[model samples]
Target: MDTKKPYLAIILIQSIYAGMFLLSKAAFDGGMNSFVFVFYRQAAATIFLVPLALFVEWKSLPPLSFVTFCKVFLLSLFGITLSLDINGVALVYTSATLGAATTNCLPVITFFLALLLGMEALRLKTSAGIAKLTGILTCMAGVLTLAFFKGPHFKLFCLHHSHTADTAAASSSLTWVKGCFLMLTSVTFWALWLVLQGPVLKSYPSKLLFTALQCFLTSFQSFGIAIALVRDPYEWRLGWNVRLVAVAYCGVVVTGVTYYLQSWVIEKKGPVFLAMSTPLNLVFTMLCSAFLLCEFTSLGSVVGGLLLIIGLYSVLWGKTKEQRLLNEKCVSTGVNKQGTELTVVTT
Candidate 1:
């Protein structure tokens, strides 16, 4: 695929995430618990991806080794199951706008974790990396300021009687706090998944095959929990409404298509280019949240969102510069070698 294609696909992925937020809200409203909703999404994704995987990667299916299976299994649990579980529940407690803003910090966490693990190198001499890190820090400051600082009350719609203005006003405003924390914790798991999956992706180059295995393994992993928790399997009836349709779209397009695109793009362009596109998702998701779900954006949200974008780009800038310098050095060496070869040949 072309370099610009992944950038375009990421837009689609962000839109799917935005749709997921809404469908999840519908699932919550339709008497489905968090675990139930998560179970459904995973089940749907697994079903959708299974056939697609068989069709696309039939010949390329790798021999499922013990080590590779373990990696994929862990990735499925952490990345797909746990990450989405926390995020889906967190969205229930928090507004979509806040969720979008908070999730933008994902890349910053990823960068630091990668650095600590020595998967990513830090060059203090490279101003780009420093600037990028600085930007990430600055964005963190903005998120903190937005989260902790004072802000006026904004009203949307009241869902339940307990969510009425009078009740909401009287209750301690900490659920959102807890929700954000959960989402952040989820981000940590996801970042770890990405770092760990790097090696697995390198070993198994077929994204479709890997994704299919991961999803199938994760479904079985969650199946045990689903059966243990829900007494009646009849409760797992598929709701083929618009909401379920949205969920299906996310499963097929986001998990299946977008994910494969991301893997291919990363393999082609490297992680730096891929990570840089993180902030764009925030923008796209925020816009979709506003229009699709009628989400209200606060001033703090706007400011915090901007800061997150700044920080995300800073990291990208640093990595891009580092790569550029490395390429220049390679070119210089190649030119020197070519000149010496010509000189020796002529003599």
Candidate 2:
């Protein structure tokens, strides 16, 4: 039962993310301003998390220096603020399915970024290295397929299409291309955040405080971005509607709750294990978008999504194999050293 906890936690986290995609898409479709939505979402997260973080971690919190604060501020600016703002716009132009499918490239992106940052080595002779390379290529192929192709749209169990003929007609190829690139950019920032977070955490080791500070800072940053772009006061108002629900759910559940849950899962099972479950979020989002949102699924999306999933698993497999080999080598070396010490003592 203890062993299964991490798996269960990850599945729950993915389900929550699936809900986020659906609700966010619904909110966007209902004519909510994406920038304002990001602002409100971060604000809500701040409201929910700040008190909790203070209550839990205040006593044991490390001293936050000015440099660390600056790091957190910049991290929040790029990672949470820009990523969410751009992703919200991308969701408006594309289906929620595509948004989820694009996220499957995160592991590959992170790997590539790690290699670029000199945090990881590339050795083509090894099977693990070859697998990682293949995964990167496969993921890129998936992204290209998703961006260019929209083959054979199929409705799944919907009596009527949610989009009107005129509305569907208004969606041009340029918009699709724009949305694809925006989503990719958002994912890239997110992957960078994930990569850089390791060092930031080491410097300021209070995980709860770190997360809360980011949320707090992002609330303000998103607000500035929102107020600048969204001039109308009406766009900032949240009524008793799906938009409000989306904001609350994304802020409280997706941002606040999932962060804690993810930390627990990562601690228990390691990051690679958690990353391997990301496809479940995509699958759940695709199914929910089809059934609830009545969104049409294209064959290209299906094909591209399959490719992304394959690439994700391939990368995860390589990472896992590499870690296993490293552990074995360390164990062998320790055993040899122990034997040598024993022989010296015997002599």
Candidate 3:
């Protein structure tokens, strides 16, 4: 049971995200403003996280320096605020399934960014390197396929609403392409956030506090963006509706609970294991969107999704093999050094 905990935790996290995609899409379909939704979601997350962070980390909290606070602020701005705001608009233009499918590109994008930042190296001579390169190419191919192709649409066994037809009418080819690129941009920022978190965490060293601080700062940032873009005071109002539910679920469950669970899972099973399960999110989102949202799945989407999954695994495999090789080399070098020292001491 203990051994299965991480798997269960990750599955739960994916399930939460699947619900987020569906709920967010539904809310947007009902004409909820994306910017306002971002603000409310972040505010909700802050409300939930602040007290919990205080309770769990208050006694042992280290004094936060201004520099670290600024870092966290910037992180929140680009990572959560921008990524989510853009993603909401993208979801408005595209289907929840596309949003989920595009997320599979994150690992590949992160790897590419790492290479550019000199944080990772590629050895063309090695099979691992070849796999990584192939994966990158495959992921791009998948993205292109998704963006350009919408083959025959097939409906699942679900209620077909007039709203679905209206949405399809509004989604022109240009809008679909724009949404695809927007989704890509959102994932890029998210990947950047993942890469930058390492150094910030080293400086702050408190996971709970760091996450809470980001959410807190993001709420204010998103609020500013929301108010600037959406001046209609009426748009800010949240009644007893799907908008409210989406905000609450995204803020509390997706942001708050998932963060805690993900941290635990990463600690126990490592990030690679967690990343490998991302395809499960696509699967869940696809099914839920079909049944609940009455969304159509195109042949191109299925084919592209398959390609993206293939790319994700290929990259993960290469990364894992590279790490294993590096560890083995270190062990071999240590053994050789120890033997040499013993020989010299005996002499």
How would you encode candidate 3's per-residue C-alpha lDDT over 13-97 as one tens digit per residue? Answer: 9999999999999988888999999999989989998899999999989889999898889998998899999999999999999
* Model 3 score (lDDT): 0.91
Collision pairs in model 1: 128-318, 129-318, 132-314, 135-311
lDDT of 2 at 101: 97
Writing each residue's lDDT as its tens digit, candidate 2 over 160-253 gives 5676223433588789889998999999999999899999999999988898999999999999998899999888889999999999999999
Off by over 4 Å in 2: 1-3, 159-161, 164-170
lDDT of candidate 1 over 1-80, digit per residue (tens): 56567677666656666666656665554556666666666777889888988897888777767887777888889887
The lDDT of each candidate is: 0.70, 0.90, 0.91
Which of 1 and 3 is the better model by TM-score? 3
Q: How big is the positional error of residue 82 in model 3, measured in Å on the Cα after superposition?
A: 0.7
Clashes of 1: 4
Error of 3 at 11 (Å): 1.6
Segments in model 3 whose C-alpha atoms lie over 4 Å from true places: 159-162
Estimate candidate 2's alpha-carbon lDDT, on a 0 to 1 scale: 0.90
